[model samples]
Target: MTIREAFTDLINQRGWYVKLEIPEGTANSTKKRFLEGKPVTEDKMKEILQRAGYRIKQVELWEK
Candidate 1:
C-alpha cells in the first residue's frame, strides 16, 4: 500500500495519536500533503511512521 494509505489506516485502525514525540503540526501537515498529492520525502515519512511504531518493509518506484 502507499505510504499515505498506510498512515491513514494506522490512524483509523490503530488509533495513532499526535503525541509530543512528533513535532506539533507535523502530522496534520503531512496528512494534508498526502491528500493534496504533494511530494513527501522518504525521511519524513520514515520518521513519522517509525514514531508511530511502524517500519517500512519496501519501497517501489515507477515512471508514469
Candidate 2:
C-alpha cells in the first residue's frame, strides 16, 4: 500500500493522537532536536508503528 494509506491505517488503529519526536544532530552537534514535537527518542516510536504497518518518514510521527 502507499505510505499515506498506511498512515491512515495507523491513525484508525490507535484511536487517539500519537505524537513522536525524533532527534536530529550531526556528530559535531550533541544537542537534541525534534522534527515535529519536542526532543524524543525515535526508536520507541518505531516499535509502535511496526504494528500499524507504517514507518515514520521525514522525522515526523502520525497522530490521530
Candidate 3:
C-alpha cells in the first residue's frame, strides 16, 4: 500500500493519534535533527508522525 494509504489505514484503525517519538534526551540530537527538518520519505515520515502521537484526524493540503 502507498504511504498515504498506510497512514490513512493506521488512522482508521487507531483513532487518529499515533505516537512515535524516541524518549527526549535519550538520543543526543536525534530529536533535534527531526525537529530541525531532516529529510524523510513518505513511509518514514508516516512512521515518525505516528510514533510521535500525530494522527490524521483531518486531511489538509495547501497548494502554494
TM-score of each: 0.57, 0.29, 0.32
Lowest lDDT 10-residue stretch of candidate 3: 14-23
lDDT of 1 by residue, 1-64 (tens): 7777766676554335555255446766766686687988767776777787787788677798
Looking at model 1, residue 15 earns an lDDT score of 30
Among all windows of ten consecutive residues in candidate 1, which has the lowest summed lDDT?
Answer: 11-20
lDDT of each: 0.67, 0.41, 0.50
Top candidate on lDDT is 1
* Model 3 per-residue lDDT tens digits across residues 1-48: 445555444434432332434444533343335445664456665665
Stretches off by above 4 angstroms in model 1 are 11-17, 58-64
Record all residue pairs in model 3 with backbone atoms less than 3 Å apart, i.e. clashing: 18-53, 19-51, 19-52, 19-53, 20-51, 20-52, 21-51
Q: List the residue pairs that clash in candidate 1.
A: none
Residue 50 lDDT in model 2? 66
Tell me how candidate 3 scores on lDDT.
Answer: 0.50
